[model samples]
Target: MRLGRVTLALLAAGLLAGFGSALAVCLCGYGDGLFTTNTSITIDGVMADWATVLLDTDNSSCDGAAPGIPPQPDRDDPVQSTGRDLLQFTYTWNGTHVQTLTGRAASSTNIQRFIYYADSDNDGLMETGERVIVAGWKGSNRRVDLYLGHYVASNPGGDPMLDINGYSDGYDLPGTIPDLSSTGTPDYSGDWGAVDGVSMEWEVPWADAVGAPGLGLAPGSAFTFHVSSTNSNPGAASFPDQVDDNMGGCGGGAATTQYAQLDFFPDRNLAAAAGTTVYAAHRVTNLGNGADLFDLTAGAPTGSHSPGVAFFRDVDRSGTWSGGDVALTNTGGGTAIDTGTMAAGDTLYILIQYSVAGGATGTATIIATARSGFDVNRTNIVTDTVTITPLPRSSAPARWPRPFRPRASTTRFASKTRVAASWMPARSRSPTGCRPRRRSLSVISADRDQARWPS
Candidate 1:
């Protein structure tokens, strides 16, 4: 029967103190450093735990240079313009959807509204992967209308696949718009509610933000967004005066903008032996908007083979040796490391060095979890498995193949007792892709020639 090299290694008799039966062990090094939303959010316009408020000072005017062009008051104007700086808002998210609340002090039947432009890929450019959410409060109907933009695969940077007028409760309408409030007009009551100068609320699901079926955005997914308010009458005083002129009813860049950051564990896995120190590498990637810091933690299975696991930051991307790398202190109870800070799009490799306790053997598994700030979730947990087998002792000389490369061969034995082999450290290139480095190797038996460990 064909067996793996690791299994063949177990054929030897009498290993050091820690070998007897097959065992498994896990080393959890990914800590809890993810920023996650704990509670769900309601679509109502009220500001709750999942919401953040934005003040009038946050307004972005389309007519910043010539305030009189839009006939809106400038920031220096003590009189305080009526149109510009007329609304304050709040925002929140709950993994599945995003909610917003806006309010103004004046009462009007027709209020000029704005839309949100999203940089989903966070590359600082609005392209095919990006999205736009058009939302506004219709004082005339005392309701809010939300529209999601679908990008044309052929022209991602061009106008959305569907025009602004393509608003409906059906999926066929350009992009899939949430069935907000009823379908048609005149008393549309789905995902929005509003009262002139009082308050307005709106909610958009994660599917709408991604623009397609396969592009689902989960918790810890982040991006940058800018809100721009527009008006038909340029001279009409608006909530916030634009920094630039609203040429020919054209809108300028976003007025209010912010970078969003989120955290989630993407990859983790490993393999090791009992009583032997094995180096395992786990990676954490940032899939958020702004820069963020991740706090990592882990959980290990209970067994006789207590494992000693240490986490080291892989300063270089190689995932091999180190250069001024930081070693995290174990927080006991399974928590192995904390990565500290990681920028968006950056990946950090966690080098986990673990060894099983002596005289212990059986299957063991380790799980690691990560969290950033208040973000934490069980869905991002990563798991690793370890297998341990007792080393066998042999009395005679035998031919052994290199590690990871198993071959069937016959040999003769002269003695009945297992021969003790001395271990020596050496570095060389091997068929196995292990990096060239010094590692532990069992080389000789009583009356046989010494064998070299695979590099």
Candidate 2:
């Protein structure tokens, strides 16, 4: 090789981790902080339990300088993972053994639980046995309730994406399982590789969810839902016999949360005396990829406040209303309430006249329900309190009155209103592009028909 010793060292340093894991390579500080802070991981789909993984390097029982290779031979060889699940970091041990590396392995115990939320009424969480009609959570018996694929490919690259069809390395485990040891089993090859993970991608549907706990019914206006995923050790899940009945995959799961809500008169705040329309608004977001079929019911604030037209927005931009957004059938009250859909990124705008709950500027609260189902995240419970103030009943001029206009002798059935005289062709003659135009006119006019004032 033309490269000198110094060049070789630099080259080794650059190629050490690039050919593989970005998480382990770039997040080296994170790896070092592992013991201080629990390692970070996330789960996309539903699975049985929490998943787990671990890392180690330089075990003396390991043969040669590295695992799975002959003592230094060919530069161009088949791209394969060394038998050991190790990270490539050039560090010296005990001030000796300087050129060695680190072994990085994930255990099956990384993930914990994937909580499916109820979507029927806006419940963001999932229950058991419910099938998805819409929204994020379907039910426990659903495939997402069972099989979840796992992979070692951490980033959202070509094959390893968050979607169900995502592929990692080549195969997928039901969930993230630990690596197989020295004997080189099927699930133990790639850093985060598995067998059962691949098949589940085709086996489940994560787009929509169901309500296992009598959820996804009707009549109720709003609800919330929640979702979670877990990981664990792979070695134990694959070869239980090898690790003395070891359970596999990451056991603790990482997660995220989001929601939707409604309000009567789902728009800007308006202050009306006793009988002014209050604009209401209902807003919905996917929170997840799943769509929601929401059954909503609303109770206008209980008070003497007058109620008029209900305000709502067309969330789907479909020029109509539908779905889990704020909607209702007025139960014979101050005002008739209407229903509509709150599509993804859509807002339902509603304007309804309401009587003041009390007298000056107070608040009114309304409750939303899915009629039959429950939202797990409690998102449906979002209430928007509106300010009700005394209506301005006194008639006032829309614009400021002119301060005593100079008298003019024109009798065009003139009323108390006075007009100030100006020039002919008026402001209309001003050439409007960038520069101001000057006009010549008479200061006073004796004739009504041909008179030009301020000429």
Candidate 3:
């Protein structure tokens, strides 16, 4: 049996107090597309580990009209300009930090800059949001500086530079890593890595990146943002067009292109045989943007028959076979399977072996549930049934016939029917009658000397 929505909510009220805000259960659509995951991603320059999360950016040149057209060519304007045509990128977020990888960096010969704007309130205007500018890059010492500030009619100089001689700010979060510090202390500003002369990467804690006096952004929170780059001559006064803008830039609709959705769903139910040896399988996937740690446990079975069972995993994504995947150790009764760690967008298969009892016949239903940070959806539980039937029995034997034996011939029976010969002959004619009358005597009287029948 499953609990109703109301009962689940009441129980969750107490169970979820320790955990952070719950994730909104929904599907993502549009923009570079929204992604959710439950795995911790490293912020190194190489983006091999970004398999779980998705990257959102624009590619159309500004030459044609909106919608089906390329962005307009670069002009002598900084506010409304299309910087580059092939500005490709990728990104992902753990609950605490956001990571971004750029396909094309600001051209070295020309003065190029990237502005990352975030509207935490989702009002479509930057008047009440945050913006981070990465500009003034030069060779050696990686002269790309990062600045954070609230937006208004003009540029609000990010007071204490976030990345200047290792001087970073403290945004008051638990176990936060530092990017840079001004007082020669440990604090995070923005950590970046060099991919190539034309590409770059950056990682920043959400609290510091969203530059507010006392503001913080948690997982499952929705917001609008724009990623734009400007192009200009080296040390020139005017900047040009910004192409590949995910959200329409400073002048257009500037609408929210993406909505952050968090969801964890198990594919379907499983079934297996009862008496015979068989396996039941289920796959659980992480559909959220941040890395999540999940706890897996089995609910009590519906039937009385207890099938001998064990769980296994496909660690290398190969088909589970001997010497390929490993068995998981049982953690008491009804508890998490294995270490219970699932990365975002990663799927883990649950292989359960059912060793049904000798005479047990019935449908045994087992419920497998996966619980992660704030993912209390009841649909996340998958139900599996093991049906067993009894084996057939043998029938009784037939009756026997009466005992009988025919008189045997001197040697062997040569005819189809056996004929018994008379011991003595009766009177037929006058001569034969007298001969037969001599007598029919007992074997003892006639054959006293020869021990034969009388004739």
Candidate 4:
């Protein structure tokens, strides 16, 4: 079977007992933190089939100088060391299922339980979206038991351990009768003479055990793994697992590669009057694996308008600018805005303000681009078009009509009081007290030469 590249880091700790002897133990350390394999794994309790799997070896006093032979005395008896002395742990996926193997010291008891946690969301927190597998020995015959469940961090009443009959959020899986053989050689053999540790192996369905809804285990799927062991039944209400020696004593490593990603929202269109300001609401979310800054820039307007543009942070996330909103300064070219450090999964709301030119008319296309600061190659862009229409003009005529005479014996004149002008008819009383009314008009005689005065 072919193997992928592996990375390892060693972390060790020691516990002293009555004799004051320091017993070195391996804490959960990365050994080939993330890797893939195509080899088929059998669930029979054996170690030869796992010889090629990446080994996350734990620290053991058996590797120390003057180490005792098989059936070594409990180094931390009264100190309550781990109920099961975890010596080695590793796992691999073969397209359909995940196979795991664990090794314990020869003197370790069969009262052992293992919990495998999967952080499928990569948020660095345990929640319902994540998965956990609990496997342990049960009954007088030491029958192997298995379970599949999720962690509910918000439910204070929820139990971290799995129940044999199944819980509200978990399922009791059929047992695989794991192989517990005492023929596995220690990966970290020091002065110990031929110490064949106890080996246990099991397998679980990939879809049922490792994958969560909407988050399946696939190539490039970023996730994390952590394995722990206890001496009590996994279904017990209260487990007294040895914490000082084996709480996180095995298989804790991240299983993903780092990358950058971003998303921009709200590509829109708007309408505004000339010489007025209009704003567009936008939001950017960081979807990468680590903290990063983003560069926001506006493209030149494409159309009849050359509107002034600026950007501001919606500090309150209200989608509109307020007194608390802070204006962002241009980094260069008056088009680029800088976003401070943003952690993974963080989101920021922004307002793009456009000051329409006084003479601007017709539509203007504005493009906003957001690029990851850590990797310029990763970027997202949104577009907005503002339609500028001319304001309505007054319908009143530029000037008032001229006054005329009537053909009848009586003569009358018409004038606009708002015009403040003088007009005289051939035969009429002095035109006075002419006030502007809602309905005012001037009528002219049909024959200009034919005119008459009051008799």
Candidate 5:
């Protein structure tokens, strides 16, 4: 069961009363290529507040482009026409939510659909669970209809017409109904109504637009997104390119390439005896917008012990080494290893193993570092400490004296050797052939030994 869309129309109305006039007066049209805005926007089918937002202009003239199949006829004027010709598209974030506006060259009564595909995980492939927005306009209608839903197929390939499902209708937005009764026909039930003018505007919450938690878009986060205009024709119906051209299966068309963030976690401390080995587990994640490789390096240990350090990829994330775990070789000196390639939002478990030398003692400090393979400047580091102690030593003598003979005569023999007092027997002969009548033995001095005989 899918949840209904939370409408913010009342909230937006209140904000408009306070900030609408100021925004309209203060904001000048934005420069080309600018995509963000800080001003408040009202979704009243008017684009005055969006003046400061940049425009993503599509190929206006019909030049028989390869991707735009059937070649959009030269209906490049927004004031007149009957066909759906997308001229420009743009969107802006006002801190709380996003407002998207699209312009068309034709204003005559006709059916037009604007589709937005969001790659929330930024993995370059369209998988299930990512959101898509469809804004539809019929003839001469004042308001636009917005439908919110997620891709349903394992691999949607960026086609909303084929893969969108379980989507619910919002405030004036209508749910998409398939025209199963007839093939290759426009689903009129999916149309929201006609636009009052040449442009259409819609709003989406920030959380709902970006996607699931932890993978949401933030500052410096990069991801691929696709926007297209369609007239419901088969195969080559979309403008700016065919629906299947440069699709998610082909890595999508527009992706940002600046961010290459790597996250390393869980600094560790371990204890081990001399001549033993110990391991510390860790995890590294790629938080950027695209797939990237990371270089792993384990610094040489510092302190009393010079333990050998090795790195491994914990394939199962079991925290223990197993057959499936791969040993990372030293691509550079001093336990440096490579992480191959990791996709955006993907995490890899790692293990740092230390081999303690037989005579090693005290503490050894090992530093683990991860550097982005794409950008050397982007790196993360963590440390692991190993406390090594020597094995305990035995103080008891290696051998014990034989049983002594009892005698009536008293003879005492003293020596500098320190022996266990409990090992001495009463009225017995010493190991050196001296006999004692009683167990009263006293030390004369620290450096002196004496012998006494009594009959």
Candidate 6:
């Protein structure tokens, strides 16, 4: 049907306006050979310094971390850097990408800035690392770059990687070993971050982070380790790049390089001390969605030149196991033995005896395998290191101070009143040191004319 002149005019105007809006969204067309740059653009409304998954537009289910993601290899354990702190990045991606990030905790716990994220691309958050190596590596500017941590390495690549075993025993977060949630002193700073750029967050139950009491990991139970990154857009082009001295998946605008490096290390090992046990917890967590525990195929990192690279397993359920590259039985669950296939949020604990073995000093390395599920190119091949002390000793005992224990049924008392009835050891101590002191009877509680010790 032929429209009137007025109607036609209005229709033409509306069509033209709609086209203009689409053109704006598409930035019209990129002039050939014109590589427009972005500082940190807003992606899906969020500013990203690099090609970070801005929004989960496809709603891809990173809902749960992949189950059975083996515990990280010792050398590959997530690193918490020193002197060099925080992770930073700068990015520019050609297309819109969807990224899923979550901070799942064991007990409805919430971490504020607890998990760090940044803006790297001008597309308003064009990229974000899967795990923050360092939080809020500060920088405000035109290039898409976010700061995380400082860099450290004397290697040839200059592109340094984190050394999980190289970190110092950082500040201790005091709390008792929690049943599910840790309120007691937990080595809170022990974190494993992934810069493979697949910045998805994994919320694991407390049970997974720690092993059951007593059933601590045995010496030398190895497990798989990994660091990976993924872009929701199948078309992202990225490769390994460094930001904030952190190495991650850097998008190359139409060149996405899905890569993973996996290796093996003990779930838990002894701290660098002799005669004293520093519970080194190496837990293999399930990073997949399914609820079954899969067998961890053990591969000995055999090399002629690599000495002291011993592997062991407690095959008989006896408190002891042979120190070699294999174990007959894979202990899983319960106290004193937290090593096994875990359900979606479960973890297996493998303890290693990490001390100056054979009077050797320097570093130790162990390797494991990645059989299936995760992309081998993106989830296999990793490494970790255990350092030998600089102190010269013949298997000397290096121990932290022990906590004070109560004497057998000891009883003591204090009073404020003169001639007050009170009692304590004659060697009672005061700010001035153990001295003969006197107290007044008035300070004694009326309810307690006398009190009995817990007899």
Instruction: Provide the overall lDDT of each model, using Cα atoms, as 2-decimal numbers.
Output: 0.43, 0.28, 0.42, 0.51, 0.52, 0.26
| Candidate 1 local distance difference test against the native | 0.43
Best by TM-score: 5
At residue 410, give the lDDT of candidate 3.
Answer: 28
Worst 10 residues of 4 by lDDT: 185-194
Worst 10 residues of 5 by lDDT: 166-175
User: lDDT tens digits, residues 1-455, model 2?
Assistant: 65676675554344333323211221211221112112223222221111112122111111122323532211112213222222222111121111112222321222222212222323322222233111111222212223222222223221211124221111222222232222212210112222222111111222223321223233222222212222222323542122111110111111111223332223334445544444444443333212333444456564434353344444454433456334445432323332333343333333232444334456555554332111333334335455666554787688744343323332221222333433223343234322223433442444445434342
User: Model 5 segments beyond 4 Å from truth?
Assistant: 1-113, 118-143, 146-200, 203-224, 230-253, 256-263, 271-276, 284-295, 300-306, 313-349, 357-364, 370-379, 387-391, 397-455
C-alpha RMSD between model 4 and the true structure: 15.3
Error of 5 at 147 (Å): 6.5
Clashes of 1: 58
Q: Which segments of model 4 are wrong by more than 4 Å?
A: 1-256, 329-336, 394-455
TM-score of each: 0.37, 0.27, 0.34, 0.36, 0.44, 0.21
Per-residue lDDT tens digits for candidate 3, residues 281-346, read 556676653444455666777886777766676556443334666777534233455425444466
Indicate the residue-level lDDT of 431 in model 2. 49
Pick the lDDT winner.
5
RMSD of each: 25.6, 22.8, 21.0, 15.3, 13.8, 31.2
Q: Against the true structure, candidate 5 has what lDDT?
A: 0.52
For lDDT, candidate 1 versus 5, the one ahead is 5
Model 2, residue 127: what's the lDDT?
26
Whole-model alpha-carbon lDDT for candidate 3: 0.42
Model 6, span 114-185: residue lDDT tens: 222222111112122211221211111111111122112123323112233321111111111112222223
User: What does the lDDT come to for candidate 4?
Assistant: 0.51
lDDT by residue (1-455, candidate 1, tens digit) is 45765553442222101111101111111123222243464565432322212211222122222233333322222213333233233344565665555444343466445445555654444455455555455556655655555332234443332224321101011222222222233121343443233455666666643333212454445554444444432222332243111111012222212232443444444444556766567776766544545666557665545577667776675666566667865332334346665676777777766677666677567776666532444224566665677777765546443565323333233444333343333453554433323234344565445544446
